[model samples]
Target: MDISKYIDYTLLSPTTTERNIIDLCHEAKKNKFYAVCVSSSYVALAKQLLEQTSIKVCSVIGFPLGSTATPSKVYEANQAISDGADEIDMVINLGFLKSKNYVSVLKDISDVKFAIGETPLKVIIEVSELNKNEIIKACEISLDAKVDYIKTSSGFSKGGATLTVVKIIKKTVKDSIKICASGGIDDIETVQKYIDIGVSRVCVSSDFNKKKQSI
Candidate 1:
């Protein structure tokens, strides 16, 4: 299905080094992937490495765990933009969402959105931690916050993106906001499934290149 353009080649490990970011950028350029997703610390280096390419540099804010304060997330988002990130992927506060504090949840996303202005923002809902109802409510809040995309997972959770959860997100958001499916996606076939179900982006690790080669 030629899913390269739909990919956000990601490297978000805590131990990720400069050499790792260098290789990630190299792989993204070689594969013609859509973007390179990295931690904020490496955004500048990735941007500099891919300066001559169209591949966007995406930075994650309050990643994996969305428990960071809203003001902190806003600052991180702004700092990432200033560091040359073309897109921002922020994790949503699962604690607030599950506690029925919809106002805090909504404000958390909205504050970052407002801070980033025109830069694209993708809210990671960490679907594995949420039930069907929570998933729907998360989508509703993301839509209310007017985010550019609602991502499936942070790849650090108990589980990653699932078709069932993606279905719920699709049904809720429809065409209003795009969907980015991340976590445990390692093959073209799986990537094809998400694309078939209307996922606009898929986040995969460097190992994806090995899988693509074997195919």
Candidate 2:
């Protein structure tokens, strides 16, 4: 499979500089990765860098850790969309999920989705932090909030995407929402494996960024 179309070339590290984002866009444009996911602060720059191309600018909101207040996340997401982010990948409230506060979790995601309006929203649930039932419940809540995609991790957590978790998300969301398997997605084979099991997008970090140096 042409994994480029299914990959979201990602750079969401704290140490990512402006130059890194610029280079990321270049790689995304050249490789035709599905999109370039960057920190919300650099959405406009990446958007400008990849302008006129089919590549999209995906900005993260309340990223990595989703402990921020809901209003802040809403405002941040709206600002990102206005700043030219074609999509918003906001981290879910893990604390709420961990505490089994399903209602709050759904509300948090729904609020962010409301803020972004028509822009696509991907909720990063960080699967590694949750158990099997928790993961399924998170998926159900995300679907209830009508998220465009359910991402597997933030990559800063314990672990990243695994085939087992991916399958659970696929079966849980089914056709109601899409899945974006991120974190630890290493090579074309791993990317293809996620795609085979119905992942709509895979966020690539090391595999893509390291290869960018080769170019």
lDDT score for candidate 1 against the true structure:
0.95
Best by lDDT: 1
Assess every candidate by TM-score. 0.99, 0.95
Please report the TM-score between candidate 2 and the true structure: 0.95
lDDT of 2 by residue, 103-203 (tens): 89989999988877889999999998999999999989987898899999988998999999999988898899999998888777777788888889988
Least well predicted 10-residue stretch by lDDT in candidate 1: 206-215
Where's the lowest-lDDT run of ten residues in candidate 2? 206-215
Per-residue lDDT over 1-215 for candidate 1, one digit per residue giving the tens place of the 0 to 100 score: 67889999999999999999999898899999999999999999999999889999999999879999999999999999999999999999999999999999999999999999999999999999999999999999999999999999999999999998899999999999999999999988899999999999999998888889887
> Per-residue lDDT for 201 in model 2?
92
